[model samples]
Structures are given as structure tokens and as C-alpha cells.
Target: MSTPLKRPYRRRNVAKLLARLHPKGITEPFAGGRSTAPERETALDIAGALGAAGQAGPAQRLAIHVLCLRWWPGLFEGPSRVVGYRSVAPTAPPPSMSRSMRCVAPCTPKPALARVPVERPAETAAFRALADLIGSRLAIRIERDRAAQDADLIRHLAAWVHGDARPNTSAAKGVADECLHDDLAARVLAPTFLASWARAVIAEYRNPNHCPSCHGYGERLQLTAVAGSRARVDVASCDHCIGQGVMPWSKKRRAQQLVIGEHPFRQYLNAYHEGALALLRELEHRGAILLLRHLGSDLAMDTE
Candidate 1:
């Protein structure tokens, strides 16, 4: 019989196959049997894990890309499959889970207040400071875009207000009113300065009202997360207000005055609404962030 052909070297075989398989050769090093390049690893890991978990979706993939790219430069460096993340198969519930899990209630968060009431002195003071800080930050951020003479002034004010050089806590105490409103208007050219001015004007002029829905007690309409499904929501009436839209109050005459609804307060309401819209615009432009942006809750302004 003819002698058997000499077997190829194991290393040579691997090298040849790898060369053909990866014409560019191994550009990135391997880590724990996987490629070290984050883009490659993430593409594989996300596809595998999400596919296995059965939650993969176009939006999820895009979200993952957005999330990963914040820290992982490799992910957004070059074009890759993740760029077409939408093309992945539509996600569906995993086949392995029991039916009970599928029918489980969606998860949700419980609402804190049963009813919302008029703003208190302490709360209003906090709000004013926060609004000022936001307006100042926006003013500074916008100053870079235009060559306004007030740009430097805006930058200085923003830095002092937002940075560690802010007004002393002792000085800020009892100085919470719109005392600085004129200062902001005079020194800052940013759009939020107008918003701050409007807020100050509203605070000065608006007649405070207890929330019609929550009553002045600041409690109305309880909200609780669904038992299991976090995404679902459940709402109930405030036990204190009893859903009647009124709460116990000793100042019956003042409450009646509020119910009578004076016109000046109405003007304040309109102005504050405009101010809110302006603040929202500032957020849209990425100049500032509202508390709701961080907590994902509206507890701060439950009065409306």
C-alpha cells in the first residue's frame, strides 16, 4: 500500500485556516478566549445574551449602542453590525418561561403623595434657587454659541452660581425671594434669564392655589406600581382628601378666597406656565436639567 500522506502540522493547519478566515489577521488581541476589541465583543455578547434572554429588539439594540458608546469608545469607532441593530429578529418572550411569568402583573412605582397642595415657603425657596441655577447654567452654555458682550458676564455668573463659589448658605437663608431676579436679567443674555424673570414675576404676582385635584393638603390620587409588571401603573384616590378634591383647613376664609380665584393670581399662573415652557425649552437645548429629569417623578411640583 502507498505510504499515507504526511499529516499537516497542527500549527500550520490552524494558521492557514485562521489566515483565510481572517484575511486581515488578528488586529485585536484575544481576552479570555474572546476578542478584546469592545466593538467585536459587545456585538457578540449583546446578540448572544439578548437573543437568549428573549428581550432583543431594534430599540433595545440602539439603546445598548447608545449606552455602551458612552464608556466604550471601540463600540462607536468604526461601522459594524451594531449600526444596523434594527435588522435583528424581532424580540419575543422567551419560550422557556412558564405561562405564569407571561401573565404576571407589570412592575410599577407607587406614587408618594395622595394630594398636592399650594407651595410652602421652604419649598418655594428651594424651587427658586434651583430655577436660578438652571437658568444660569443654560446662560453659560449658550454664551459659547454667540459672541455677545454679556457672554463673559453670563459665564462668570453661571460659574459662581453653579460652581462651589455660590452664595453662602447663611447669606442665602431668608434671601430666597426674587431678590436676584433683576441681577440675572441684567447680567445674563441667555434665554433662561427670561424664564427666570418670568418665574420671579409669577412668584411675586400669582395667588397660590391648592391643587384642585390633590387639594391644599398636597395629597390626592395615590399611584402604586403594578404588583409584578414594573411597566404598568395603578392609581387610587388620596385617603386624606377622599377624592373630594378638598382637605381640612383652619384658614377657611383664605381657602375661600382661593376658591373665589382672584384675577392677579390668574395672571401669575399664566406667567408661571410660560416660564415652565421656557425651562422645558432650555432642557431640550441641553442647557439645563430639571429635577424630574433625574428622579423621573413630578412630586416636586404636585401643586398643578
Candidate 2:
């Protein structure tokens, strides 16, 4: 009978070890097996992750890119809208898990050590910042685009301020109220605030949820290897989020969090509809002035 080949056994061993392969971003239980790249992320890292997560379309992506550039223009080089990351130093294993692990018996080719990207404060902030910028940009873009196409808002403004106050003389003190109305609407850019509801609407469009860590869900899947004689995949509670699902950026939880949430910037989102309608009615100015005032407080004025 032909003898069993030594190469085959070595190859089989390699295959077994690889069967339990854990790539970056995947949760593993080893104490220090995590990758350290995420500890100090450049802007490119955050943008790359965001691009990979998949936003709705180009406009949404542009909105987010602009927002990031606005917030931290110098954090990274290159366009935020694309995934071309600035060259980073080669990844090194974490201190505790730095020992080289390899198949003892020779195989055709050995498996390279896996690299895990750790999510640190800066990277987490980038994700949260991108989400906020995208949401706000979407709101303003849609509202203003729609308003630009419709003239009713301008007409109403003119109607409310229909005539100009005459100086009790022959000269027309102001252009016909219609002209003045269109001018005001143009100045306020159709007063996107009316679509103040657009903030929440666009947010919902993006399927905005709660905790960044778990996408608002409170638990994450923990993958464990079977202990004794066999290799099997088992599910366990995620110790990272403490099963709370939300990963907060703070002193205790320092490693880059895999989960995403809105805990950092949700307060910045504006919901005009939630405000008292009576307050809007109390404005003494004509429709044009009142509309402009409403839009002045917005963080999202230009949609381009």
C-alpha cells in the first residue's frame, strides 16, 4: 500500500488552522489578538470605513465628504468621497499578541498573520461626524432642490408683504411687493427651514437608528471555538459592548468600537417641527422676514 504522504498531513493541518480564520473587524476572543491600526486613525481610515458601510447614493456620499472636510480638513489627505486611503504604516500586532504564530510542520505556503483594525476615538468620531454631515446635507439638499423648483413659497412671501410703504410721495419706495418677495426667497434660499421636518425625514431615509455600536441593537454576536477535541463555531455574548450594543467613547472602553451609534452628535440634528408652532405665529415681520429668520439658525444652508 502506498504510504501516507507527509505533505498532505501538513497541508491538512494548515487547512484546519485556517478554518478558524478570523479577519479584521470580525470579533475574536483572544485576549490581545486585536489589530492596532485603529488606535490612531487618519481621516482616510474613517472615510474608507464609511464608504464600505454603504450609504444610499452619490449625493449622500458627497454630503458626508463635505462635512468631514469641513470638520477636520487637515486630518487626512485625498478626497473623502472615495476609499483611497493615505498610505499607512504597515500594521503591527498588538503587544500581548505579537508573537509569530505559524504551522510548525512545513506546508507549501504558510498563512500570513491576520490584521485587525482597532477602532479608536478619532475613527469613531469620524464615523459619527460623517453620519451627521450626510444627514444634514441630505435634508438641505432635498428641501432646497424642491423649493428651487417651486415658486409658491416666493409668491406667498410677496402676497403677505404685497405693497410697499409709500413715503406719502410719487416715487415707488420699493419694487412691487412681488419683486421684493422673490428677492427675499432668493436670499434665504427658499427658507429650507420650512422643510425643517426634512432633517428627521432624511434621517429616516438613511434608516437612522440608535447606538453606533450595535446600530442601536443591544447585543453583538460573539464567535467562540469549541474547547476540547473538535473545532466548532459557537456563539457567545460580546464582551466589548457589554451586551448593551452601544459602544460609548470614553476612558474605560478605549479600543476602537466595532459598533456605530449617534450618541456623539444626535443633539446637533435640528427638528423644527418639534418646536411650538405658536412661536412661529408670533413673529411680527412679514412672511419674507419671518421665513428668513427661521432659516438663519440652520446648520445646513447650502446643499451643493
Top model by TM-score, which number? Answer: 2
List, residue by residue over 98-151, the lDDT tens digit for candidate 2: 234424433334335554444322334544444454345544654564455345
How many steric clashes between backbone atoms does each model show? 18, 8
Candidate 1 lDDT over 1-304, as tens digits, reads 5423222111111112222223343222211123233322223433343233224444344333322222122323333222222223334533454567646844433333333233322323434444465455445543433334245445545656888576454433323331223443344454544455434433322223334564432333344666676643334455655543333223333223334233423322233334443443333222111211222223323412
lDDT of 2: 0.33
Candidate 2 Cα deviation (angstroms), residue 301: 42
TM-score of each: 0.17, 0.19
Regions more than 4 Å wrong, model 2: 1-22, 29-140, 143-152, 163-304
User: For candidate 1, what is the lDDT?
Assistant: 0.35
Error of 1 at 65 (Å): 37
For model 2, name the residue pairs that clash. 38-118, 119-256, 211-261, 212-259, 212-260, 212-261, 213-259, 213-260
Clashes of 2: 8
- Give the worst 10-residue stretch by lDDT in candidate 1: 8-17
